[model samples]
Target: MRRTLLLLIGVFLASCQSGKDQKEDVKQEPMRTPEARKEVVYQVFTRLFGNTKTANVPWGTAEQNGVGKFSDFNEKALAEIKDLGVTYIWYTGVPHHALIQDYTAYGISNDDPDVVKGRAGSPYAVKDYYNVNPDLADDPAKRLEEFKALIDRTHAAGMKVLIDIVPNHVARNYEGKTNPNGVEDFGAQDRTHMEYHKDNNFYYIPGSAFAVPNWEGGYQPLGGEKNPLSDSRFKEVPAKWTGNGARSVQPGMNDWYETVKVNYGVRPDGTRDFPDLPEGYEYKGYQAHADFWADKELPNSWDKFRDIAEYWLDMGVDGFRFDMAEMVPVEFWSYMNSAIKLKNPDAFLLAEVYNPDLYRAYIRKGKMDYLYDKVELYDSIKHIVKGYGWTDHIPVVQKGLKDIEHHMLHFLENHDEQRIASPDFAGKAELAKPAMVVSATISTSPTMIYFGQEVGEPGKEQAGFGSPTRTSIFDYIGVPHHQRWMNEGAFDGGQLSAEEKSLRDFYKRLLNFTINSPALMGEYQDLHFFNKELNAKYDHRILTYARWSTGEELLVVTNFDEKKSYQLDLKVPQELLRKWKLSPGKYSLEEQLYGSVKSELLVPAGGAGEFRIELQPLESRIFKLLRP
Candidate 1:
């Protein structure tokens, strides 16, 4: 009787479940893909962005000159950043690193002053791979939650997040306190005595203890602060190699003394210990790359970093900007990046590789999406801005890097570069207008600007670790010009002078156009040759170039000469006209950048198109061709 009752109940439950399943058979939502748009990365130093203190005190602690927290990146600040047309925000100094500040009360260990760089330590010297800097948190215990909330807020504002991933080296006191279950720290499973093990996290000299370097240049850790751990001594059995590849027991003061080099299956004899990338693997997808490693044995360090990166990605971080990527072997990047992409295909991978010869190898094999164009494009533009290089050389650089031009990221100022308005650089912010135009419009590559660059932040502060010219990344300091725009977190630019406001407005216009223009990502044609021949009055300081796509075209011309204005009658070549198939007629050429200038383009019968331009000193004109 009981069995009969159970059978009847089961039949009734099954009938109800079938009805609910029918309701769930609706149309499935389409999978979303990442949008294809020109990227503009705004690199903001997280600790310094929202700080309103303008004490300008040299070697000051966080108390004397307040530090910016993660909470400071409020909706107003992010909205203002979006207004400036930033697609990605590279929040510098996100990872937890060795610092002089004492966070022992939060169950975090204290870093010795002898091994730390400044009051706010070097961001590159990462100490905990699983956590963010407690200094950036509102409450030290909820640092990770705070960062995750920031990521959510950033996505809400229509911008992606990018943070540094220093794979080449780590802090001298590297630890992973917040690592997940079953995950080990970097050196936990290593054989330290071998010094050449394929699985060891760091290269070490057996039987030697690490020593602190002799102080020089009147500089000391914490500026010779009176502390118990500031005794200018550090102890590490079997001294590891320094970040700059110094294998000495004691590295020099000028070397990267606070950090130790990470080993990536490379031997001390300069030969790879792991499997080499297969030939003709340049264009393979990430799945193929990841599959190649499925059966193969990789070094433990590679797996460890891959896990660390996946951890961040799983925690809602979008991408990484690798620091000193060349220091690590390319094979390791192949393994690590492939694993990352296998998880999330849209992860943006950018690297800092200065060697021009290694650019293609890193991009094709290592799967890097973008590289810094500092040595080639940035150096050429800086020379021109300083009245040294010629505009003719600019076109040559553009052509020389034509194959990988889109992969090269252009920037005028970063954390490591000189500020545009500094005396050591251009001395006047107006001098950068022409260069900024060229840098933004001259290529298909993404353009980056430092945090305070738009408002002309001359980094003339005598901060602790570094002097003026560039903002101090190692010190706890405030940026005066950027603070005026911060306006006590209102982000309204209320205190900016008229000149500063005009400069910022120009930046806004240029950046907005860069992300929206279709012709910028199109094909390029040099107009200098035809312009020089058609008009004898064409000045050498003036540069002319054309970019076009189907139904859209742009004519970009700039005056590099800061002291002279030029009246140019630039002619579009017949070959380009034939390629564009532009008929013999008059067309309107509107300046798209500032939206204040308009002119006419005359295309006569069976001849070239001629456009008259009146360029002022430090002027850049991006004229879009439109049908009349």
Candidate 2:
């Protein structure tokens, strides 16, 4: 009886193994697929990303003001960010900068308070290129390794990582303690006697010494706290130029005195000391720019910055967001970006250039992949949301940039912009829903959102450097709303209100759809004219447009009016009907977002398709066509 039982058990195990092998033979091969649509970047202030503290004393010391650390961004936190439909995670303020905090035991020097902006220094005023901010790491000695682990974790969560590259300036007390063996600090090989030289790393005033600005208005360095280094005196002969190119030894208090201007062979006069690009070089590619700089001699500052950028890239950074890119000469960018692309052709390069006229020049010549659309789209949307502008200007902005619309990255808030929920701005976060829908769907360019914008983080703190309405990038403080979502590093929205959770839900749906849609990267057509013809009472605050690709079509309409609801008979133009080859028929118009909302479209014999849409104040709808 025992032998018979053993033989039956062996037969049963063999049958199970044969079934598993059959299932494996029929399994499909896994493959990597390209991203379907344009990317979405979520910008997070590294110091404020995970801090849960609420104590925000003005001019507080580091202990009084707790900070977020690199370890806070573990696998679970990163997965939550990825689930939010983000393609790139921009970790702002990651570099080692001059701050009032003392790190002397680690062989690093503390910054003088008269120069540093806040207890935590400005991230743009970089102190060392090869090292990260020690304040961001649990183990200060392992800061760089911690950041590398962050990069690895971000990639593991299927998101790219970007950090800042402030090429135009560096900290006033620039030091390179963690630089590699062959690297030298800026100004280490400079000739300080001359005002300008082709190879000098800094611009200098001819015959003056650096002077700290005279203080007034109840403002003192360290808020009147006496320190051994806060004697209010910094010694310097032949003062270097300020970050804003202030030539005087005594720059105004408002000037960027904490940083020094980098010399890129641009002389005190308005002439270039290095070789200029060939005429019409803006239309060329990175390879052409690379060839142009192949045999040319560049300045010392350019070489230094290139080395710094390449060092970061070699450490697995996907890209860089350039701060004050226009302040540096375009010729240097042509050389630097070419070298970068040669190393990593798919690197994402974004520049902060505000001038509208120089947009094309910087994009085409400097090889920048994207630029902040702050002055145009963001400004216009802000006015419209503030009840100062009309929706008619939206088409004008889009038409004016028809040729280069793909290069503009849209954003409603960043480290530099005011919070949308601030009283100085729209005073209501919900009022931005329509504007965000338009910003994300209007063009093929990318879209970015600040860390707490979705949960309505009001920048109302009395931090040291700046006032309310804009989050202080200079202070060590907690972002209240985002911290709630963080939930003591759980990264769950346990403390969020019902309204805040709903707002976040809307954002999730819209952003997830954005990353999955193919028609978003296809052709666009404005339907405002056709819809206006359908009803003279069609609200001027309402805008309509259409986007279509080979097998997909989408019609997007937004109501920007916060005080009035709108019900209009929207019309599709005859030109579009002929192009789409739809005859007289009825079709279902299903709302892509909030799938329960649906409408019907009536196509008359040889004419346009008309549909009636009712939108609440600041409501947006993305309708997809389905067969009747």
- My TM-score estimates for the predictions, one after another, are 0.93, 0.93
Candidate 1 runs further than 4 Å off: 1-35
Residues 450-481, candidate 2: write the lDDT tens digits. Answer: 99998999899888885788888888888888
How many steric clashes does model 1 contain?
0
What lDDT does the true structure give each of the candidates?
A: 0.84, 0.84
lDDT of 2 at 330: 71
RMSD of 1: 13.8
Give lDDT tens digits, candidate 1, residues 68-160. 999999898999999898999999999999998889998889998888888899999999999999999999999999999999999999999
The number of residue pairs in model 2 that clash at the backbone is 0
Estimate the TM-score for candidate 2: 0.93
